[model samples]
Target: MTIQATNLGFPRIGARRELKKATEGYWSGRLEDGELKDIGRELRKRHWSLQAECGLDVIPSNDFSYYDQVLDMIAMLGAIPERFADIGDGKDLTTYFAMARGTDQAPAMEMTKWFDTNYHYIVPEFCHDQHFSLSSSKAIDEFLEARELGIHTRPVLIGPVSFLLLGKLRDEPCRPLDLLQRLLPVYRELLQRLVAAGADWVQIDEPFLAMDLDESARDAFQQAYDGLAGSGVRLLLATYFEGLRDNRHLACRLPVAGLHLDRIRGNDHLDELAAELHPDQTVSLGVVDGRNIWRSDLDATLELLEQARELLGQRPLQIAPSCSLLHVPVDLSLERHLDDELAAMLAFGRQKLEEISALARALNGQGDQARSTFEDSRRTLHARSSSDRIHNTAVAQRLAAVGPDDVVRDSSYPVRRKVQQAHLNLPGFPTTTIGSLPQTMEVRRTRAAWRRGDIDDATYRSFIERQIDHAIEFQERIGLDVLVHGEFERNDMVEYFGEKLEGFAFTDNGWVQSYGSRCVKPPIIFGDVRRPEAMTTQWLRYAQSCTRRPVKAMLTGPVTMLQWSFVRDDQPRSDTCQQIALALRDEVADLESAGARAIQVDEPALREGLPLRRADHDDYLDWATCSFRLATSVAGNSTQIHTHMCYSEFNDIMPAIAALDADVISIEASRSAMELLDAFVDFDYPNEIGPGIWDIHSPRVPSSEAMTRLLERAASVIDRDRLWVNPDCGLKTRDWPEVEQALTHLVAAARTMRESTSQRHSA
Candidate 1:
């Protein structure tokens, strides 16, 4: 049997986040023009060289992006929004970023989770008369760049159908897929250019084939590839993040040279795929998981492939990761601080590439070296399974002890609102910023110094306290009704809680891009999770002491803690989430005990964690909502519980969100102009709601009049008494100046609405 090793994509953020620094520097004008492009070129060159050195038979180019791949595809097809038409050339960084981050003249395109993953993508906006043309030479240029470096590479592009399916139709009466025919010609032109540039293979990623598709969507895929089939380059139709399932027959029958299957997520359908494959086509088996950090079980994987080898005697097969490695860290060996025991069970993008290479060699019957590598993998798997530290008896017992009563609050929303309102004594439109303020350069440098032991603990603590004091004074000066400690003592919300909790591991340079120039190092949950002590109580108490206003205690919610982390696969995710919920439940009780009146458990990932297929939604929502309730049920009725969600579509899961039962739930609504609040309005959502008035993701500050209009619209649907005012999310990603301007307007808008409401009542 002949087998090849390959990669779908690599992390463009770089080993030490070089791309992030360069991109942000360019945005701030700190780096001159073309400097960011230089960094991108360097990252792509380094990534290609690394994959080639790892013995990959096929390396993918054009997988790197200045911001996101979806936006890249949009640019390649000349689908720039009409608002950005007056900017620079269609392919320049200024126009591209203007579309993503928004110009003062227009709002940015909406963004949401990339399928079920935490990574966010800039949503494509298509008009009724949207036109397509070959607007960019990025794919061809990258392919030739790799060729010049002596590495023949396959250029990857999001498939024409999936690209359309992932986008939105703005001011149009037709579905995005209706424009498929217009989109295909540009794709064909790009493919022809690549063919002319000496490209032999192109990986067209159609991940939506794994999603539940209607008949029209299914037909769109066939129509898309059929049009591009005439192009003179070999097309490898790639599907990841799921198995083909019901679409297996259609996917396998597609007129393409090769098909890649995500065996890790959709292993059960492999037998059917083997039966359905065309004689001349190659089948790439995704044996290694690309979304996580766990070491693969080589013995079991090889055995499965051996069975598959027999299923198709001489048909060419390739071994690759299930999806792009962009979701994972760049390199594992760069982590010098991780202990031997934990590091043995982990694999980053570079390590996953090596694993893919080793598997290919072992499958091809190369030599003793391959066998030795398999043996090492087997040992690591054994160590991971048998490690006593993975199973915490006390944590397990506590989770088992959790009953239905533990997930219920003391009273319903009406009763809790009355007590909370009286105790807090706030205004009609309660104004507050989200949990975190900006993490400035000083904050980052101080944290780094503390971590490196260059500064003493006392010095760091004092610095944090002063920052908190500044934040408090700023909020009070702005006339905000509620307040936060600004989260100066913390880093990434999930990572901070992970550090305080047991059974979680950290990486020094495991950064994955969350959005444009924004990255997060998701903690590795390798073992049983339990909080060692009060995670946020000390900070909450100190901040409360410094302010007369009710200082809110911010905690990352249980569901988010699970969804954001690289969790353990050894247990059902629900069980692990329950353990985390219990841990946070303790933290919640401690915060309330410390006299924290308002506690915000931010679950920005709740909707992101929902199963992609509707059939699986019920089971996931049940556990997810139950987990959130379990965490916050410990708060007293007077301790107003708030939860936050951002960059997500909550309309479908409003019931599950209401089930979270937070007294006040805040969500991202500014970008949509209060369209998301229609879900709450339709559901007659009982809890108090805070429809965010500011789009925190952008640097452009909205005028108070604009925010007031949004508030008036929200009050039109939601009861005036139930409305609260806040930003779409935390201000951490924004700068201090924009944050100050934005919050200043947010407060003014709330006051304007209050006065307007009072005038109407008096009349």
Candidate 2:
């Protein structure tokens, strides 16, 4: 059997985030067009060279993107929304970016989490009359570019079926899948072009096969591939993030040259797949963990690969990462600050490639050649399993003591709402931010300086306090009823909490891209989580002192902290989440005791962490919702508890969302034009809700009239009195000028809605 080492995809954001700097510079007009393209070319060439150096035989091309791969596919298939038609043809950067970031004339396309990952993708908008054509030559160009660099790479495409499934209908009475027949010609043409450009194999990623599918979807997949059957290039169909449980026969029987399975997530059907494989087809085993930082347990993984090899005698077998390495940091060696002991247990993108190559050598009967790598993996696994740093008996005992009452609030949401409104009386249509204000260059510089010991504690604290003063003054001046402390003292929502909490470790440069030009260095939860002391109390107290308006104490919720962190796989995720919840519960009690009136625990990742399969949803949601309640249950009825979620499909999880029992919930709505509110409307969500009026993810500043129109749409679905005004998410990514402009419009929209409501009541 021929054995090879391959990669599904690589992180497009460079090790030091060069792409972020270049993209943002280009967006700000600091970099010329040629300069931006030069940077992208340099990064791609460097990435290809790195993979080749690591001994990967089947490197992937066209996996890189300026924004997201899905958006790239949209441009490739000419699926640009009608609003962007006048900008240019779908090929230019102006129209491409306009669809992702929005212009003064059009709002940005809707964006949400890609599957269960924190990586966001620009949602495709499809009209009933959507036309399909080969709009961009990115795939063909990248394949030829790799060939020029002496890398015969496999070009990756988002499979036609999965692409259509990932999109939403712009108008009713039309299905995105119905456009499949029209979309297939574009895929076929792209494959033909790649074949003409000297490509032999193409990896078509159909990740939706891992999710639940109907018969129609299965039919669509058959139709899509059958149309491309004779495109003259070998096709490697890839599925990841899950296993094809029921769709196994469909996937295995597809008319493709090969099939790649995520052996990590869905390994139960491996033997079944081996039994069902056709003689002409190859099987690629995804053995390495692509979404995590932990080193692979190579001994066990080798055993699994050997089992597959035995079942499929003399068949071509490939070893690769379970999915794309885009979810992980680019390099582990750059993290010098992490001590040697802790660092030994981790693997980044480059390290994962080495692991893949080692596995392939072992599978190829060259185990002795890769002996040192195998020995290192064995030692790391042994060290991690036996590490004393992993377990905390005290934390375990505290978690054991948790009871049903711990997850229950003292009163229902209605009772708490009455008490909260009576104690903190405010005007109708109250406006608040989703925690953070802009963390400007000064704030970032001060924090960095303090970390580097260039500035003393007093100086940093004084600077943070001044920034808080400015934020409070701005809110009060803008006539917002509720306020936030701006969170200038914090670096990230998750990392800030993890720094104060025990059982967590951090890396100086373990950055992963969340979305466009946005990178997050997720903290690593290596042991039983425990709060060392009060985390945000001092800052919240100082901010409240500067403002008469009730300042909401913002904390990252337990689920988000656990979801965002690189968690230890030693224990069940639910247990670590519970430990985190208990820690946050203590913080909630302390903040309430410190005279904080309202507390917002942001759980934006709660929905992002939902299990992809429907059968597993209940078990995850139960523990997830329980964890959130366990954190906020300590708050008194008069102490308002709030939560925030963004860029998620809430339609399926509306009941679970209600189970959290937060007094108020704010969600992202502006990008979808308040369409996400339909879930709340259909469920008749009882608690107060702040359907966001401004899309903070985009750089464009919205006008008061636009925000007011969105509020009107929200009011049509939700009660006006129960509604609040807020931005879709935090303003930390945006500049102060746009934030001030956007929130000014937000407050104005609230006032306009309040006046209209009052007039209607008088009438």
Candidate 3:
């Protein structure tokens, strides 16, 4: 039998982010339902045609969605909360979107991080009395739609176990597994519908199995699959992100028709899993990398797949990506501005499909069709691996030379605080903000005009200076102890520096969704990284010159810069991060020399770089921590280095955070109700801490009383003198009105704290 090739999933956001614009336009009443349906149909048709062109034997359908797969599952299981069910007929497109994004009368469901990726999923809220019935058949509909186009497709759905595990407990503490018995009938119904609709294969994604699962969760997985096994549709259970360590035994014993494993991140499990596979079962060997933009080494991947085939001979091995192609951009060929050499070293979603197809063909002994492509890809991979441009001997040596003395400050916090008090003479409860003010539409228009050469440098500079002056004056009026120039000139924290630095290339339309309504175009680092000139000096110097108040010079830290960018695949990530750190070391020194007293290097993505498995996190954190020190350690003792991190769970990384030795560190704690402050209380972190006083994600302005309560809670754990009050994150996404109201309350909250402290001192 011929080995069938398949995709676990494909990109849902259409090329050019058509789905995003169309979805937003539809919600805003700019586009009619018919027009939106036409866009959706067009996108699905294009995706199916691409898969057909790549010669994938089992092309996936039902993967396309307006928002996210988790939202689709909520709709499928008829788990509509009462608040959202009253919008319209549940089948209407308006109701679907309303569930994803709230309308005037209803607030959107809460969104949370999807696994470890930046993409957010609509959290499924379940009541204690939740009942399951098959409400919608999106899988059957998409399968028949593809069949009408003469393509037989495998329908995809989140497995019953994973779906419930990802949902939330609304009314009571009910484990999602409690609803498994009730949820299984709906899955069986859906699979039977797909089987009736002429779908021979269905892909059930159980990625949560890759994580540490308790006994109840594992039993739920087996129980749910046992009920669905007789539904007539062939089952392909898929897992990604990391290897199935403890779950390997359950995975092997499952009664599914096939099992898919990610060979990129989970390569260590290949041999052991191959030995344990059931003789009658089919194994889908995911040989191509899916999460990154680097081109695959076709020769190497083919060799590995062949080895797996020999171990499980005639087990119907299929070649595919390690995960869905949603994380990567659409096509590298669309990037016209990238240099030819670097372009040759990269692959995106469209190109990765071709790689999978070619690998399958070569493994099946139809080698002639893929020979030319294989030779070309191998040569490119070898050239990159051997290129001298990837290595910086001097930077490597400097990283090695970093001793314990370099990471430590000259004195303790008490001595340093006394010295700082003598120099600046600040108030009791210091009030400052994380850098950035609102980036309005007018600012974007001006930036676009400047990029097109419609405006001169002097005109653009004047525009930026005016914004900065307004920000500085407003901060002064609000009585803030520290001021920021308002990062009006930056498009993004990391992209702004990538634009000014050498050896980096950016794309005009390379947008990856960060969260809801937020996207970032990560720059591609190709050659040896170097700072051609100072990046933030001019704007920072101008802002510092305009204000007597201490201005915090903002920079994205080295680890974050490397994490957010499409880094070079030629070298180890640790080495490349050090090169970036060395570059920032110069920028930090320049900021100090240019009359800046405090500098905040933001490392929000630092925690994200931690390994998914506990076994590998320490090594990753060691290099990551070293990289941060290499950047900030160049500054003097009096410079008051500060770093900001948000959306992080710092309980695990608290020790590494203290090791960086920043004089002050700010984190997002207001949303968590200052619970993260317990880490500081537990560790007794000597550095000054800024636990954010308000959540900046929402537009609602918090009251002074609310902010005061939060500060009081922080004061119970942290010493008042070592605390600084600030917002959770930057204000770039907010409007001026909201920003002003929020900071006004923030300053008022600080005054209340100071009054309480004074009363205690008098007593």
Clashes of each: 0, 0, 0
Error of 2 at 625 (Å): 0.3
Top-TM-score candidate index: 2
lDDT of each: 0.90, 0.91, 0.83
Cα lDDT tens digits for candidate 3, 264-313: 77754666776777777888877777778888888877777777777787
What tens-digit string does per-residue lDDT give for candidate 2 at 1-763?
6599999999999999999999999999999878988999999999999999998989999999998999999999999999999998779888988999998888889999999999999998898888989989999999889888888999999999999999998786878999999898888889999999999999999999888998899899888888999999999999999888988989887899999989878855666777787876888888898888899888998998888888877778999999999999999989878989899999999999999999998878888878988999989988888888888899999999999999999999878888898999978899999998988898899899999999999998989999988999988998888899988988999998899999999998899999988899999998888888899999999999997789999999999998898988888999999999999999999999998999999999999999999999999999999999999999989999999999988888999998999999999988988888778656988888999889987777889999999999988888888998999999888888888888888888888998999999999
Instruction: Give the residue spans of candidate 1 off by over 4 A.
Output: none
Candidate 3's C-alpha lDDT?
A: 0.83
Clashes of 2: 0
lDDT of model 1 at residue 588?
A: 94
Each model's Cα RMSD: 1.4, 1.1, 3.1
Residue-wise C-alpha lDDT for candidate 1, range 1-763, written one tens digit per residue: 5699999999999999999999889998999777888889999999999998898999999999999999999899999988888888888999999988988887888888998889999888888888999999999999999999998999999998889888889786789999988888889899999999999899999999999999999999888878888899889999988777788889977899999989888855556667778877888889899999998898888898888878866778999999999999999989999999989888899989988998888888884657766777888988988999899999989898889899999999889988998999999999987799999989999999998999999999999999999999999998899999999988889999999999898999989988888899999998999888898887899999988999999999988999899999999999999999999999999999998999999999998998777888999999999999999998889999999999988899998988999999988999877878668657888888899989888777899999999999999889999899999999887888888888899999998998998999999
Task: State the TM-score for model 2.
Answer: 0.99
Clashing pairs in 3: none
Models ranked on TM-score: 2, 1, 3
- Displacement of the residue 450 alpha carbon in candidate 1, Å: 2.4
